[model samples]
Target: MSENKNKSGVGMKRSGGMGGGPMGSFAGPIVKAKDFKGTLKRLLGYLKPQRVKFIIVFIFAIMSTIFTIVGPKISGNAITRLVEGMIAKYTAISQNTALLKSGKDAVIPIPSIDFPYIGNIILLLLGLYLISALFGFLQQYIMAGVAQKTVYNLRKEVEDKLSRLPLKFFDARTHGEILSRVTNDVDNISTTLQQSLTQLITSIVTIIGVIIMMLTISPLMTLVVILTLPLYVAITAFVAKHSQKYFAAQQKEIGELNGHVEEMYTGHKIIKAFGREHDSIKKFENINDRLYNAGWKAQFISGIIMPMMRFVSNIGYVVVCVAGGYLATQGRISIGDIQAFIQYSSQFTQPIVQTANIANIIQSTVASAERVFELLDEIEELPDTTNAKLIEFPKGEVKFENVDFSYKSEESLIKNMNIDVKQGHTIAIVGPTGAGKTTLVNLLMRFYEIGAGSITIDGVDIRDIKRGELHNMFGMVLQDTWLFNGTIMENIAYGKKGATEEEVMKAARAAHAHHFIKTLPDGYNTILNEEASNISQGQKQLLTIARAILANPTIMILDEATSSVDSRTEVYIQRAMTELMQNRTSFVIAHRLSTIRDAELILVMNKGSIIEMGNHNELLDKNGFYADLYNSQFTGANLDNEVI
Candidate 1:
């Protein structure tokens, strides 16, 4: 069920994966892309269709940031209005002593308050802010839709691509690495677009608008604001460049750490059995320490952007204030204009700070994008044949002629191998560990293509047959049983679509699983947990056997099918397997020679070659390697339960 094609041999060991994972959580890679411009272009292509929405977002962002930019200017005007109004009124009242004396010295009338002017301007400022808030809200809402939909499409493509990928692809990467690419990387793109993209636009617009406003007040003061721009840019670029490498390292280290955690957790029982708890902890800490080093460096470098910019901007601010005061004294600009210019000068540095921060975020997004694009760019499985035939339940004759294969092509594992089997004849493939037992099946099932050779079913080449048709002709029960979180009945009948309740029960009975099912509280309706942890190993194996039995294929392949169960359970499974093997060609891969002593044709394999091929008794009479292996079980030469 897991599609573990080459589950043994070199593929089982650790293969370093591609990117960041859970430990770094939302913190994406810090590395610069090999082609930043190209990646950015491709990333934007997803949003290209939402041009209208983006345009609206831009307009709204400009409106919002501009309003924010204008707020301090408006406040400056209010202050000037209050100050000058009070002065003019006082002067007028002092010159009108005659009117004050006529009324009464104690009854000095306060100048009529400019209630209408103040009220109208306050309302106008409120109206501007209300409109700005509306645009800002609309911008974010529409952008969220576009961002989420883009990633939704991306995730779909990744999922679809996974199904078409070759076994070698999965073989080369850990599941955690693939998971990080689709989920963590895609999420990074979404977060950056929705939050950082809009912020970037707003920051840029604010910078430009603040510049224009300052120039209008006085170009001399605008120079003061502009003088600090280069310093801000230099600081951001320097820190960002240094931080980028750490982010990349952080992503890689986190991915490795996560893969280790996933591996260790899944194999915790094995570790404990071997008394390797201390070793496992030490291994985890090594990975964690590398991740910590990278993470700290990345944050520390990027962290320099804000405070440094603030320090430089503060100096510019002081310069502007002193210059503005001089110009105001010379009467070249109104106090109000000088005040507005001061606000603009202060506002200028904020966007610089924001842009610098967003630059750091963009680097991360690009890192995520690079990994995402890399996965999408991987070579998929070879396309199915154009004129493929659909062989339905071909007579179980299978042949392998002049076969050759190697994981790395230079070191040939299988060379010029040949095998021929008659219909309904039991073929038991025996081999030592790493003897390419699973790999042989993998090639037969087209999980991996042979380097040189042809495999056939009933005189027709397997390649000529459609993959789906070929798969339907064979039923495989590997040592490792896989089941989904579903009812016991559902898991058993999985391969047989829309199977009747009676039919499912019959298959379960055939696999010797019905007795256990009936004993359970839920009978056939018993639910399985995600890992199928609720049932014993024997029970899970029985369920898989039942599932395979329901398929009713022309041939059967059992790989260490009874290895996990006790001797008593093994007897029951053997009976079920014998019953299932009746009238069907069976390929039983086993290490227990005793179980396969009755096999019609025993193929003794060593290092990917068949050293001997004959019936059990015939091999024993020959007293060859097969005889030695069979004799070793009784002689105690092979201490393990499995045959040598």
Candidate 2:
């Protein structure tokens, strides 16, 4: 099953896994960056190339906000003009009425409202608003491009870094954890840059512009509005401080839930076979319950922010209204100015709230940037030697002299191991689990650098050769087959670049996979799903063998290739192996002793050293470790436990 599919077969998607709600970014848990200043500086470095676009964005954002900020005041002026006109007309009417009552011949002309002036003001306001919208759109468009490009470069660097990193790096981390950094963390940065960054600039500009406009109208009213700032900050801080832990808990629970879903979905077959579905469901319910508790608490706490802000804002509004009304009555402020002041007061609180929310979002974004940077900063594999050697035609002769290696520096696994493999010789290695059977092949392939030794191929040190060229010398078909989501023909042809249809079919026939290919509905064109579960295990193994056969390298590695198949399938695979190994140096690691009876050399390994080396008949005559191990297969003795 796809990891994206939840237990109920529903698709589950997360944005940064921060447990944010419908309120968008405002409801997420805040994640503080460990090195805020440093990480922020580094993140800004990615924007340096797009500094021109960002500068334009800044200018456009400020211009858009300024036009909007001045609108309320201008509209207020129009209101004052209308009010003054009405008063003048009323006064004129009263005078005319007095004259008529006193029987006077003359009468005052009643003043008409200046509709043209009001019309002009309305038109000016419309123009300003339209210009503001245009600027806003341009800035957003430019910013989106900049954000995408910056993230593109960052993602690319991370991908390139992964290729350079040693295998141990991957071995030490879970696939999901690494994937989260690549997918989720990178996506978070992209979202912040695209949306929050522009909003942040506009918000700050709005707050400053609103304040300036309010002060111009009435400093007293401005002061009243300003007094409410501390309350907003206090409420925001209080809620954020208390909600931080719950948000953190929520994020943790989300990760656990995702991990559990992924693990169960991938191994669902095993769980069902073992009849653990009930236990799985119970465990899932337990995780879901914890997630619910953490999620609601985080949301409820963060959710109160806007309501609390509104409450404080209303208090400020009332005080400003009272103050503005008094100023207007004293003729210290115009009625229009008072109205604009109220609008400014209302506008003031919004940007402050947005700014606070953006601050939290920026913190989370920086934390995500830190994770991606960490991956980029991981120690990579040692660079190949300068002027690396390349063999045009490899002879398959291999020698391991005084090889010493270990996964960890504190404990040694292979110590001063030595071996010589002639061209076209078959070497069969038999050992218990953790007995260094696979480690020997790993050293030969230079998967890990030997602590102290020299491994040479055809008299050239493998280290001296280019890593790519060295890898090209061998073809490996492991017990665990790996086939991607592609046509079977494509999978088989993966071993040889630009392989033709005929070449692929020839390799498949040699591996005895052609018969199965013909039986499938689409034949060689049949597509394998992501896990390749559509085909049987034995069939998957045969496809891998076909791929290896297509490569036709000088050396072959058959690592327990037939270990997982049934007896009947094993016979078919063994026949394919015989043909593949006819004229090539091959290393076969097997648990079953009977499979390697025809091998030129059979090495019995224990702990980290070769305990005995000989042909099957010679080892059996000697009746030593190899003899005991070989005899135990038929005798039904637990040789692995007893011998180790």
Which model scores highest in lDDT? 2
Per-candidate TM-scores read: 0.84, 0.93
For 125-236, candidate 1 gives per-residue lDDT tens digits of 8887888898899889988988888888888888988888889898987665677677777877888888889999999998898888888789988887787888877876
lDDT (CA) for every model shown? 0.79, 0.86
CA shift at 188, candidate 1, in angstroms? 1.6
Candidate 1 collision pairs: 30-247, 30-248, 31-248
Measured on C-alpha atoms, candidate 1 has an lDDT of 0.79
TM-score of 1: 0.84
Residues 1-644 of candidate 2: C-alpha lDDT, one tens digit per residue: 33332322211123352446533455565566799999999999999999999999999999998999999999999999999999999999888888888999546888899999999999999999999999999999999999999999999999999988887898877665678788878999999999999999999999889988887887778888898889988887788777777776776666678768888987989999999999999999998999899988888887887788789988988898888888888999998898888898888888887887788788888988988899999998878999898889898998989988899999889888888989999999998889998888888888777899999999999989988898899999998999999999999999999999999999999888899899999999999999999999989999999999999999999898887678887888788888889879999999888889999998888888888888999999998888778777878675664543
Scored against the true structure, residue 468 in model 1 reaches a CA lDDT of 80
Error of 1 at 198 (Å): 2.0
Candidate 2 matches the true fold with a TM-score of 0.93
Worst window of 10 by summed lDDT in candidate 1? 8-17
